[model samples]
Target: MRRLLPRNSLRSRLLGDLWKPLFCLLLLGAVAVFFLARHIGSSVYDRWLYDSAMTLAEQVRVEDGKAVLDLPKQAVEMFEWDQVDRIFSDVRSRRYGLIFRNSDLPPPPEELQPGQSRIFPHWVKGHAARVVAVAVPNPADPADVLVIQVAETMLKRNTLATDILVLVVPVLVVLALLVGIVVWRAVATGVRAVDQVVERLDSYGPDRLLPVGEITNAPAEVRPLLNAINQLIRRLSDLQDTQRRFIANAAHQLRTPLATLQVQTERALREPDAARHGQALSRVLKAVTRSRHLAHQLLMLARSEQSGEKALQMQEVDLAVLARDELERWIDSALQQHVDIGYDGPESGVEVYGEPVLLRELIGNLVDNAIRYGSVRDDGRRGGAVTLRLQVQPIMLVVEDDGPGIPPSERTLVLERFYRRRGAGGQGCGLGLSIAREIAQRHGARLVITDPPQGMGARVEIRFAR
Candidate 1:
């Protein structure tokens, strides 16, 4: 179920998390203050009641072993007089039932002793009162003791309690307000810092893909997010630089073929002799074919670059079967160039996981490169042999030719786009080996260029991990 009130903002979540415990703390503090005020009010009034009971005790005396009051009626009336509370008093002896009394009050305990006092709440004439009870020894008879109790109505205590609440509650509320303000300012400052980072991102364009610099006064908690954003910007900037260079190189490579095609078309259209026109047309067809192959290779290279984002359409492909089929397809083209082509592996059962179309492209590029470059010798002879060898144990594909082998120093260089060897003898652009290497990598295989073990020729091997 969805939340009734979802906390969507960082500021609100932070404040909510912090203020829950803060609110509880304030509530407890208020409760403590209320009880403290009540205690203070009670303590102040209880002292007055105790003193009154003690004064009444002093006025008592023992006459002929009987406890009596030597106080006058006016004195009693004056002692009990108050503006806010009604006062009540009683004097009694253990030996005698009662000695003197003013009004009905709750009596002290039966086991009362001299010089001890207790204060508590009681009802005086159906009104709430606070009572203080004291006991005194009779002077004439040490065995006899008198108990005295004094109580007053609750008016003065209630007024003191109300005054205490009035004085304290506002101070507590102001303190809570100050704390809330501080918390709100802190949350707002942090949120503003994050908003500033967002604003900086919004201001960026494709031409200005710069990193977000460190923000001043940003909290330490935000440092990791800034670092991640800067890293992403750096990657995007690097990718843009690579794309620009790729476009420039691709355009440069296609220019010669297009110019040749244009010239051949113009010549074919202008020639008067049928034979010369037919020859010009053939050259134009060859130029168009070369241009088409170059464009297809460039598209393949772009696809390889973008294929990282997609899941491979993987299937169990027989490596030996794939190589034999590719070799068969290229044999006619090889014979036309006077280069013998053969396969040296099992007809089937050498299986690996890869996309079939991409695998075919990989093998085609390798075989095409072998036919174009491996058929020519240093002396320009056009008869040589190319072999496709596959190993089932380690799952490898090796394409080797009996021609001038690439030098060790130039092996890695040839894998880079458009990196032809210094004395290379082929009409092929340098994307063949690089595209083969890209496809090999995507299939969890490694492509390496080396010389044949028993002959001096270029040998390219793709080793798939078992």
Candidate 2:
């Protein structure tokens, strides 16, 4: 069963994570504002109601110890036409008395006592009414009871609350949307700097190490990352400059000696003594051959160190045939040293793709190096047998010898340029294996050295990629 993974849309997820919290906070704030407005509005209305009630109660008088209200016309109008009703009652009798009230208004249920107030639910002519009852002492006559009541319809109060909500909700929504847009833009602006840096780095290669010129208006927090990127560009440019200088110097130094040896060899052939002339000719030829080999090795090393993808002119070549051809070419030298050289593999061709000339050089160098350093034995033999075998399925080439194998600790060291082993007999430069390794790397192959089977000799294996 496959489990579902979260979808990969960034904007959707960002909104999903942000909108809930933001909406909740906005809703809480709106509710708080609504309740606060309602409380303040109700308190102001109650104060107006109390003032009107007190002023009307002050105009009352007592006739023979009975209370009578002398409410002014302005005081009566102060209740407002929208108010539900008004009433006066006797506080001692606990009964309603002179009620100069509108027929559309509901009366209070009971009279109010001295210093007492009550709110009553009233229905007046198809409208809701809120009635307040307050008690007052008769000022002119003692032992007289009076009560005043005020009522107002709730239509205006409901309209005001609704108006406040209508005005407030839209403003809150607009503010929330504006805040969301600002946050998204700010985040995008900040992250775009990193995007530009990545694009510049992606376009870079060994040939181009220039820093990105565009600067971001990022916050101070991200300054370190931009600084580090600039530092890396500087370091890479320095390394590339150093590598170019080294290659140039090596080519110049090696070419001079080669040119001098070629000139000297041509001049030395003019000797007249027959025997001496032959010996000198042989020495000159050997020197010329050594110089040519050195030049070839140096060129191969320089090409391998170049930083880019090389164009490999690959073709299918037979490994067994190539190995046999190289061995036959070196047959005379093997016979002189009394070394038995042989190639062992399938008679049919084993095909591989690479530069055939480079492959031949790689195989030839391994075989030659084995014969030179692999000749000494405990039985006092001048040369030993060298065998080259190709394993077709694994795409491997193995060269083995009865000569003393390199020690385990020095196996890696021998592959370095000009690194010669102790007590080894060799006249040529120690670049044969190094050149072979370089060519193997270019062909996407690995060269490994280890003791051969039966612990008798060294085995060199070149394994090619499939």
For each candidate in turn, the TM-score is 0.77, 0.44
- Model 2 residue 445 lDDT score: 93
Top TM-score prediction, candidate number: 1
Compose the digit string of candidate 1's lDDT tens values, residues 1-466.
Answer: 1321358878668878877888887778777777787789889889888888888888877678666887877887799889888998888777766788889977688766787888888988899998888988876678888889888898877777778777887887788889888988887777676888889989987587888898988888888988988888887777776677669878998999999999999999999999999999999999988898889888888777655435788999887787887778987889888998888889999889998888888999999998888888888778789888888888899999888888999999999999988777877889999999999999999999988997688999999985
lDDT of 2: 0.70
Q: What is the lDDT of residue 394 in candidate 1?
A: 84
Which consecutive 10 residues in model 1 have the weakest lDDT in total? 1-10
lDDT of 2 by residue, 94-179 (tens): 34356344343344345555788776656655666566667766554445445666666665566666678779989999999998
Which residue pairs clash in candidate 1? Answer: none
